[model samples]
Target: MTLYLLIYFIIIMGAVVAVISKKLINSAIMLALLSIGVSILLFAYNAPWAAVFELSVCAGLITVLFVSAVSLVKHDEENIKENRVKYVLLPLLLIGFIISASIIVPEYFSKLQIFSTYNTQKEEPIGKLIWLYRGVDIIGQLTLLASSVFVIKHIFFKRKEADNGGKI
Candidate 1:
């Protein structure tokens, strides 16, 4: 229980820091931290495959893409106007929503228990489940990763073209 709470705290703090960060790189790093926290939580919940996927795709791949994208963009900090009040209030609002959901969501789920169905069959091994039952999900994840790579490559190509005065 204490470990779960600690992970949750890390996730919340990471999210808040990501949202409030002034620099894009810092935000991307915090987002990776958030994904790591989530991956840990999934592992704690006995979902190793999900945890691995979250760590690899979200924390590793997406963070790299975000950092690369942010690096490619020219920052004109002096010309950018930020509303500080929004950043200050957003985390507070998020905390309030989380608190309310914690209070309300359990009761709602408890009520739903009456209508829920349980699978009493023995669980398949993770390897069989992944390759046999969840082949489509695996393919989808691969497709998403491939598409993101292609998109990033396309962005780099365009930036290179612009840098070379459209000579490509």
Candidate 2:
């Protein structure tokens, strides 16, 4: 609806402005807010699964990564002026792509309501839906988490001890 579109536009503009601002930490927080906006739009469009995925993966995981990176690198108080446009360009493009796909792809998937709306009985709970229908996706997510941990340990945490010849 028009109301949804208006709200989406406002949230997106807020995201862009936040990314363009001078603070890196603020930009990361805004990126999380932008992900929440996408989640809202997903839920509004009747894709609760996609909404949960966005909230868990993009908003949760990526924001944690940003915060870890920020903490690892101490904040500098110096105001280093750079081109503001560079920071927001990629995120803006990604948002535009997502918005376009959300609008256009639905036309092809108009008949998908048949599959999405299927429920065997009222006895089934949400966890049953997740485990029965989406178990493989959950396993894949765990694999990704394991891989991320491997990367952090090998790349970020590993340190080599120095060796020097004693004979001079």
Q: Name the best candidate (by TM-score).
A: 1
Model 2 off-target regions past 4 Å? 76-81, 84-143, 158-168
lDDT digits (tens) for residues 7-103 of candidate 2: 6886777677666767667777888888888888888888898899999998999999887776666455244667657875868687799899988
Clashes in model 2: which pairs? none
Give each prediction's root-mean-square deviation over alpha carbons.
3.5, 6.3
Q: lDDT for model 1, on a 0 to 1 scale? A: 0.91
Write one digit per residue (lDDT tens) for candidate 1, span 29-117.
Answer: 99999999999999999999899999999999999989988887847643589988999899789889989999999999999998988
Provide the clash count, candidate 2.
0
Which residue window of length 10 is worst by lDDT in model 1? 71-80
Worst 10-residue lDDT window, candidate 2: 159-168
Q: Model 1 reaches what TM-score against the true structure?
A: 0.78
